[model samples]
Target: MAGDVRAASMTARAFVEDYLLWTRGQRAPSRIAGASGDVRRELVALRLRPSRGTRRGRPQITELRTDLTSPTAGRATARVIDRVLGAQYTLRLDLARGTDGWEVTDVSA
Candidate 1:
């Protein structure tokens, strides 16, 4: 169970990192490979798409934390604190265990 939680945490962290990069145009959407359709839609709804004209630089991930209320429940939440252009933002991501691994199901800021 500990290992499962750790894996889920890692997955959540990686997803956040990749998603931030994608937002900055530093990475492609494919970088967020394990995200669910709902997660993608949430990004669109949040207007967190990549920059269009000038490519933005990478954001720094200052803090990342994951919470698994129930290891066996196959669901987890990740909170990420990132710094971009000297401003900080908090993002919350919900994840669920899938057949291929953990997939991000939702996102909010």
Candidate 2:
């Protein structure tokens, strides 16, 4: 039970980090690997947006916190604070554990 929660948290953290990178264009769309469902479609739609210029550099993940809302149901949510060119952005992510492992189901800013 505890192990499951830890795993889910880790999965969510990794996904959030990848998502931040993807948004900054440091990572390719195909590389946002832990996303699925609506979140995946959102990423596809965002492909047309221009990536951030290299002058700004990559975004830094300043803080990340994950809460397991339902361990038995394999559901979790994460709050992330990231810095981009000195600006901070807060994002919320919903995750679910499927047969393959944990995957991000939705994201909101």
Best by lDDT: 2
Tens-place lDDT digits, model 2, residues 1-109: 7787777778777887787777666666567767886777778777655444632555665666666677534444444443444566777777777898877787787
lDDT of 1 by residue, 7-75 (tens): 877887788888877677665554576678777665556555555543446566666666665643344
lDDT of each: 0.66, 0.68
Clashes of each: 0, 0
Best by TM-score: 2
For the record, the alpha-carbon RMSD of candidate 1 to the native fold, in angstroms, is 3.3
Q: For candidate 1, what is the TM-score?
A: 0.72
Residue 62, model 1: lDDT of 67
